[model samples]
Target: MQVLFITGQNQYGVVSHFLDGMREDLESVGVRTDSLSVESEQHIHRDLPQLLPLQEYDQLISFNGMGLHLEQAELSVPQYLKQRPVWVFCVDHPMHILKRIIGLNVILLCVDEEHVSFAQLCGFNARLFPHAIGKQQLANTSMMPLEDKSNEVVFPVSYMDSGSHRQALTPYWSQIGHWVEQSRSVTRFMQFIGVLPIGNRPASLTLNEQILRLCVTVDSYLRAKQREACLHFFAQQNVNLTVIGRNSHCYQSIAPTHQYLNAMDFTDLQQKIAAARYVVHNSPGFERGLHERVIYPLALGTLVLTFETPYVNQTFPQVCLDAKQSSGQISDKEYQQRRKQAHQQIEQQHCWHHQLRKLFTSPTTSPDSNGRTR
Candidate 1:
């Protein structure tokens, strides 16, 4: 089998590192693989086919359909790569015309079940393909002894332009249908009956589009707020915490007690993670699906201290930590046990090879009846 992968230039360059493992794993199984990095949406629609000669490739697997310009690809790619399997691994919800573009030749693999349901509702083939840890990470890490590891807990912060977002959102918040502005308890009651407010919906959005935007915005705000609160909670206890990312002011409320560090390349960051006693991960807020943060630490056998949510609670009950507690609460032996369990589970069930096997072997219909989703 031969495969061509198209992926976005993700923030901080972690996607590139993950794909390296994928290439190695596929090659080890006697399958040839190649990849293309889409730097911008423009590159996807115009330069993709020219850069990636699909003639020799049996399959085209794309990661993050949002970046692939799927609508454009739907129109152009078929002209050149006719009948070739085109699999889009969607990491985010399909909110655009891309949902309407998935046809018999195009298969949707989504990280979020909500996306799968949406695609299926639209009468398109979709499957749940959650994020996974790359095996290469384990190979590259040189784990430090528990005693020698840093006591300081490190967190990678997501950058946000709060001022601009707030300015844009304020008016829309006020314009929400008055029925939504009831008391907090009443609002909750209304939500039970499916009467939630369309918070900060843009003027151009239709009702369905605004509702989708509202859901995404609400989740984004909840995550931003939860992250801030988590940082503040730790900082107040005078815990030795380090925040690593491009912007520190994003969580500036915890500035006095927290130290800031610039985000490093994935290779360098893995070394730091392996040497750290514990890496702190803030929940992506509420019931949102897992982020790469959880699996990345576990792959390297580093203890992760994250906010307890339903997904984490169900997935890694042994490794879950209460946000109120200090890092020292867990004994070194207990930490080691959790780390080992996490590593084993992720390697067995959530690694790239594990997922790819399911993708190819599923009895469900495959491209060309070859039993491969590509």
Candidate 2:
């Protein structure tokens, strides 16, 4: 089989690493694959269809429905690819996914179950296919030694918004944003509302319900505060920590004890995670998806210390924390065990090769009238 892989450019170039890994995995399985990287929506609208002839490939795999205007635009790519199957690997919010390709003849592969349900609600074909560790890192047959690791702790996070970004959003939600950020009770309440299971919920919602739904859809304020809270907590501890990402200026001010690093490609970041004694991730306030940060480190045999959530706690019960704790709270023995179990879990269920195999072979690909694929 032949495949066309699409990914976008990010500031850190992490998406490139993921695309490279996917291409390698497909080739290993005897599939002819090619990749395209786009920087903006104009790049996708103008350049994607022309990247290759649709008849030359049997499948198209798009990473993150970024830069797509399928619903509104009269596009050639979507029309041409309708003759074949198109699979999207989306990590963004559910609403963004729904907005981009609701009416297209595409198979939606979502990173989170909530996204799958929300897409189904909008009458689009969707399935829950979570993100997995890339083939490059997973190819390592042996785990690295603990002593060889350089950093004691490593974390990669981006500040939710900059000053100008806040100014742009403030006009619409200044008061509501303040309430959600300042009040812990309000944030928790909103988070609970945000975590409501998507499939069985009422079809028609009241105005208040719609507002809460909007919170789930657009959760930048809560994410920013959550990252701030995690940084503050880490700063309070005496552990040696290294943070890498854009918007370090915002976090560096609060976490004086932690060492800040510059934005980098995922290849180097994965190396850091493998070498670190512990990979730290604090839960984002209202976000329900398992981010690449969490999955990558686990695949590399790093112990992750993050807050307890239904998704994390239920899916990987061995890795969840009892309370909001820093790296110092964990012991050496505990770290060893968690790291071992994390690696085992990744190899068993969360590898990219396994997900791809399922994508092609699973009979659970049929979409219902309501857009659900059971």
Off by over 4 Å in 1: 40-56, 66-76, 80-85, 96-105, 118-124, 161-163, 175-216, 285-288, 324-328, 365-374
Task: Give the residue spans of candidate 2 off by over 4 A.
Answer: 40-52, 66-76, 97-99, 162-218, 237-240, 283-288, 308-310, 319-334, 366-374
Local distance difference test, per candidate?
0.62, 0.63
lDDT string for model 1 (284-365, tens) is: 4224456666778777777777764556556776765645553557788888888778877877777778777776655454
TM-score of each candidate? 0.77, 0.77
Every model's Cα RMSD, please? 5.8, 5.0
Candidate 1 is scored at a TM of 0.77
